[model samples]
Target: MDVQGVRAAYRRYARHYDRYFGKVFHDGRKLAIEQMAILPGEHVLEVGVGTGLSLPEYPDGVRVTGIDLSPEMIQHAQTRVEDLELPDVTLLEMDASAMEFSDASFDHVVAMYVLSVAPEPERVIAEMRRVCKPGGRLYIVNHFRNANRIISSLERALAPLSQLLGFRPDFSLDEFVAHNDLDVLEAHPVNLFGYWTLLTAAREPTCRGGASPDLERSIRSH
Candidate 1:
C-alpha cells in the first residue's frame, strides 16, 4: 500500500480502533513497554500510535511523542491523552517513513503493530533508528506471516486486500529484521495464543562513535 492508501484505510478505522483492537492487543503492548524498562525523564517515540490505547499505561515522568499518518487517528490519540491526563504526551499526524524529528531525538523508540501497514517499512524503521539515541532500545509488536505452511499461504493470499485492510497480512519477520539489520536481543510470541510477536533490540554502544548508525548504515540517505 502507498501512503494515500494507508491514510485512507486508517481514517476509516480510527473511530472504532479502540473498540475493536484495544483489549485484544493489550498483552503485547503491555509486554513491550515492560521490556523497555524506561527510566524517568527519558524520551520515547511511539510510531503509529493509533487511538493512544497505550498512552495511559506510560509513566507520567517520561516524555512520549507519538506520530501517525492518519489525522483522524491522531485526533483520537489527542483526546485520549487529554482525557487520561497523560502528562508529557504529544500526538502528531505524520508519516512514519518520513518523520520531522532530529537525529538522536529519543531515548527509545517503539512501533506497535505498525510495520505491516507502513507504506515503506524500511524507511520507517530507518527513521526510528535514526531518531533513537545510541544504545537505546527498540521495540516492535506485530503479526508476521505465520510459520505453518497452510497459514502462511492464507496470509499471502490476503496480500491483495492490504490496501483495504490497511496492513499486509503476509509481512515477514526474519527478512524485515535482517534487511533492517536490527540486533534483536529477544523475540517471543505474545497475545491470544501467540498470534503476534514482540521483538526488542538494542543499538550498539559504538553507534555514537559513528561506527554504525541507523543499524542499516546505508539507509541514512532516506
Candidate 2:
C-alpha cells in the first residue's frame, strides 16, 4: 500500500483495531517485550503504534515513543496513554520512512505488523536501523513469505492485491534482513499457527549468522 492508502486504511481500522486485531496480535506483542528484557529508563521506539495496544506492557520506568502515520490511529494511542496514565509514553503522527528523530535516538526499536503495510518497507526499516543506536535491538514482528512452496506461491499471487488487502502477503525475510545491515540474533514463527515471524537484530553490528559482509556493504553504499 502507498502512504496515503495506509493512512486511510488505518484511519478506518483505528476504532475497531483493538477489538478485531488485538487478540490475534497479542502474543507477538507480549513476546517482543518479554524477549527485550528492557531495563527501567531505557528509551524505546515503536513504529506503527496502532491504538497503543502494547503501551501498557512496557515496564513502568521505560520511556516509549510510539509513532503512526494515521492521525486517527495516533489519536487513539494518545488516548490510551492518557487514560492509562502512562507518563513515560508519547505518541506521534509521523511517517516511518522519514522519522524526525535524530540519528541513534533510541536504545531499542520495535515494529509489530508494520512492514507489510508500509509503502516502502526498505526505507521504513532503514529508518529503524538509523534511529536505533549501534548494538541496540530492533524487533520486527510481521508475516513474511513462508518456506512452503504452495503457501509461498499463494502469497506471491496475492502480492499484487496488497493495496486492497492493506498488507503485502509476500514479504521476503532473507532480503529484508540481509539488506538492512542487521545482525540477527534469531528469527522464528509466532502467533496464530505461525502466521507471523519475530526477527530480532542488532542495528549495524558486525555481520552475524545469515548476514554476509557483501550484503551489508551494498546497503551501506546506497
Candidate 3:
C-alpha cells in the first residue's frame, strides 16, 4: 500500500474516524499506554500519532513530539493539543520508516495500533529501534491474524486486499521480535481469539551509555 495514499484516505474520514473507531482503537490504546507507564519528566516520541488520541494521557512536564504521515490528521491533532492546553507537544508530518533524528533520540517511543497499517512494518520497527534510547522502551499494540481456524481462513482470503490496504503481512510476531533481538518485557493478548498483542521491549542495556549530553542540552534549551 502507498503510505501517502493511506494518509490521503484517512484525511477524508478524519472528522468521524475517531468516533467510529474510537471504542475499538482506544480500548487497545488504553491498554498499551497503561502498560507503558509513562512518567513525568520523560521525553516521548509518538509515531503515527493520528488525531493525537494519546495526548491526554501524557502528564504535564512530559515533553512529547508526535509525527504522522497525514497532514489533515495533524491539523485536527493540533487543535486537540491547543484545547487540552498541552503547550509542549509538537506534531509534524513524517514517515515511520525514515525518521530525521540521531540515534538514541528519545526516552520512549510509542506506536499504538500503528505497525499493522504500515507498508513495511519490519523496516519501520527497525527505525523505531534506531531512534529510541538504548534502554528506552519501544511499545507496540497491534492486531494480527486471528488464531481461530475460521477467522484465520478469512484473513487468508482477504490477505491480498488487506495487504494492499496497508494491513500487516501474515507473520508471527514472536518470530519477528526474536529475529530483532529485542528483550521482550511484557506481552498481553487482547480481545477474543487473541487477535491483538500489546508488547513492550528494550534494546540490551549492555551497549547503552548514560543519557546523551546533546539530548539533555536540547531538552534544557527547550
RMSD of each: 6.3, 5.3, 9.4
User: In model 1, how large is the Cα lDDT of residue 212?
Assistant: 27
Assess every candidate by TM-score: 0.90, 0.89, 0.83
The residue pairs that clash in candidate 1, if any, are none
Q: Which whole-number lDDT from 0 to 100 does residue 140 have in model 3?
A: 81
Instruction: List the candidate 2 regions with Cα displacement exceeding 4 Å.
Output: 205-222
> What is the alpha-carbon lDDT of model 2 when measured against the actual structure?
0.85
Question: Which sections of candidate 1 miss by over 4 Å?
Answer: 204-222
In model 1, what lDDT does residue 65 have? Answer: 94
By TM-score, who's the top model here?
A: 1
* Model 1, span 19-73: residue lDDT tens: 8999999999999988888899999999999889988888769999999998999
lDDT of 2 by residue, 7-108 (tens): 878878888999999999999999999888998889999999989999999999999999999999888888888898999998888999999999999999
Residue 13 displacement (Å), model 1: 0.5
| Reference-based lDDT, each prediction | 0.84, 0.85, 0.74
Per-structure clash totals for the candidates:
0, 0, 0
Residues 1-222, model 3: lDDT tens digits: 778667766777679867966666666677766776778877889898989988887777888899988888888899999998898898998999899978998888989877777767777888888998877888888775555568668777777775344455454564456555656676677644445777777745323233222221222233
